[model samples]
Structure formats: structure tokens, C-alpha cells
Target: MIRHHPDKNLLLEYASGSLPKGASLVVSAHIQMCAECRAQYRTMNTLGGSILESCAPQAVNDKAFHRLMGRIDQAAEPEQQVTPERSKSTEPMLADAPPVVHKLLEKNPPIKWKTIAPALKMCRLKTGQDQYEVSFHRLSCGGKVAEHDHRGYELTLVLYGSFSDSDGVYSPGDFLLREPGDVHRPTVTEDQECLCFSAVQAPVAITGVSGWLLNRLIPFRPG
Candidate 1:
């Protein structure tokens, strides 16, 4: 199981349609597979609906409303029957493909992987001008990600294996949101490799001797 998750604020923004398209897509995909996130999204939706209802309403033409209702009624009817050839053509390809996990492991990502510490691999998936950047991190068994703090908010989603820090142990489908003041040292377990997808606004500020070595080799953008 992968451990990690996106920040609540980010999820709220996504539910309200305020997040960027790319980030929203990622969150939507994650929510599709994560029941916890789905619950959060439902809460956000409820909150948004309340806010919308509190606002003044615009007048609608009576004829327009009637026409819209008629159209909706038509749409509610069952779809026309399909022929065997048409049914086959309309079916989704690779209908059984695993969720976002496979897509995240694309060989040709916009950002290429750069070796960091021994047994650690890092790759940036987006640039900060986009409001957030995603990073793909792979750590071998027993690997350490070095203690670090964030400048802006950081969202981590575990896709494979697990990692632990001061906060707690995170496994697959777990989400974590680290604000500016948060700091952590992620350590992978000895039994399996850990893969994580992180979205951050700034680079990680590394601490300690091991962190210094990692900072030098990782070529990460400074916070």
C-alpha cells in the first residue's frame, strides 16, 4: 500500500472548481480510487452548494425554463438500442487497465528523472509557474529521503509501498499535506521499494549532513 495524500485545502479548491486543470485532473483521478478523498470531496460539494444558495439568484425566462425542462425530460429517456458492431466499437479499450497507477509511471514524462542520493530517484513533472509542480520519487528498500521542510504547501500521494516520518506511517492511498512549517524525514521499508507523487510550490529545504549530500546531488529547485 502507498501512503500519502493531498492537502485538504487543495481538495476543497478542486471540489470548488478553483484548482488548475492539470492539478484538478490528478486530484479527480486520485479521488476515483480513494474513498477517503471521495468523502472529503462530497463535503466540499455540500459546502459549495450552501454558499451558492446564499448568493442572490438571477432571473430566468419562464419560457426558457420550460424549454430546458422539456429537454431534460427528453434526455432522461433510455438510449436507443445499439447493434453488435456499434456496441463493440463503443466499448472502452483496455477497460480493465489499472487506475492512475499505470499512467503515473510513464516512461516519457515532461520532467526526466535525475539521480539524487544512492538508491533514491527524483523527477519533476511540472514547473512552479503552474501554481504547483509534481515530483516522482522512487526509493529503494531502507532508503532515506533526508529531513526537509517546505516553503509552500506540499502534497504527497503514495502509489507503492510505504514510508514513515514523525507524523506517522503512510501506505498506499494515504494522503498527506505539509504546510510551510512542516518538516519530515521519509524512510522506506526494507521489504519493498516506495514510490510517491508529490506536488509542491517550492523546493525542499534539506537539513543535516546527509541532507547536505543529498542537496548537492539531487539538483532540485531551492525553495
Candidate 2:
């Protein structure tokens, strides 16, 4: 069962199209997986539509009709854009993916997982900008992540298996938001491997004396 979710404020921002692109993507994926969030999103959209309809209408500029016609003409003869070729890796199956994520995977190459630590493998994805770094973290049974605190906001979505932190245990389809002040270490459950998608706005600051000393040498920051 899903035990966690993004807060109402973030969902409202997503519905109003005000969320940053990286954060928006994470919310969109969660909406697809959680029926409760999907219902909330639909309700928010409805309310927004009602508010817009109640607003006073403004008079169009004199050149509006000409501009509309020009746009129509351009649409009639659309330009053919070129896209990069796909690599040799097999294409990702749609399966349970949301439309946005599925389309993105179709355009890009398959994920190439890399080992970052013993029992931990990571597959990073481009967020199309430097403001956020997104990655899929895979942890083997009984694996543990170093204790750390976020420098900015961090969003984590559990995609497979389960993990536990100081707050509680998390299962698939769960959403967690960690702020700059929160600090915790995550450890995978023994039943199976845990896979999670994480998006961060800033690097992480390692906690504890040992981690702090290692951070100076290895820069244990997040993307």
C-alpha cells in the first residue's frame, strides 16, 4: 500500500503549472501511480477552470486576428525536425510507465547502471537542465545509504521493493520530500532489492564525524 504522498501545496503548484520542470516530472509520475493523487489533480484542474471562467474577459488587440491567421498558416506547413538516433540497447517497455516517462525513454537510450558503492548501483537521467539532478538508485538487500541532509529540497519516489529510514518504512508508489534540515539514512529491506527515483535541487551534506571527514576528500554531495 502507498503510505506517503506529496503535500497539497506542491500538487496545487503542479496543477497551476508553476512547479519547476524537474519537480513537476516527479509529481506527474506519482499521480500516475496513486489513485488518490490522480483524483486530487483532477479536482484542482476543475477548480482552476472554474476560476478562469469567472474572470472578466478582456478585449482582443486589433492585430490579434492577423496573428491568429499567421499561426494557422505556419501550422499548415510544419517544419520537419530531426532527432538523434537510438543506441543499440533494447527499447524500454511501456508496462506501467506514465505517458510522459514512456515518451522520454522512447527518445533516449536505455539506462546504463553504474556502481557507486558496494551493493549500490545508480542510473542517472538528464533533467534537461542543471537546476536538478535525477537518478534511479538501486540497493541490494540489506544495503544502506550514508546519513546525510539535503542542502535544498529532495524528492524521492519508491518504484520497487522497500526501504526504511528514521521516520518510517516505505513501499512502492510512496512519495517522500526531504527538506534541508532533515537528516536520515536509508536501508533496504531484506526481502528484495530496492529501487527509487530521486530528484534533488542541491547537493547533500554528509552528517556524522566520519561522513564529514570523508566528504572533504570525496565530495559526497548529490547531483
Q: List the residue pairs that clash in candidate 1.
A: 1-172, 2-171, 2-172, 3-170, 3-171, 3-172, 4-174, 4-175, 5-175, 5-176
After superposition, which runs of candidate 1 have C-alpha atoms over 4 Å from their true positions?
Answer: 1-10, 20-26, 46-112, 126-129, 210-223
The numbered model that scores best in lDDT is 2
Candidate 2 similarity to native, TM-score:
0.78
lDDT of 2: 0.71
How would you encode candidate 1's per-residue C-alpha lDDT over 1-223 as one tens digit per residue?
4334566877777765566543553565557557666677777767877998999988889998897575444322212121122111111221221244234434334445577777778776543236666666778898887778787776666656788888899876577777897888889888988877667766677887666665565544521
Pairs that clash in candidate 2 = none
User: Per-residue alpha-carbon lDDT of model 2 for 1-223, expressed as tens digits?
Assistant: 7889999999898777667767766777778778888878878878987998999988778699687565444222211121233323352222444444545555556778778667778776765756667777788899988888788888888877889998999987799999988899999999888878778888777787777664565332333
- lDDT of the structure predicted as candidate 1: 0.62
Off by over 4 Å in 2: 58-95, 210-223
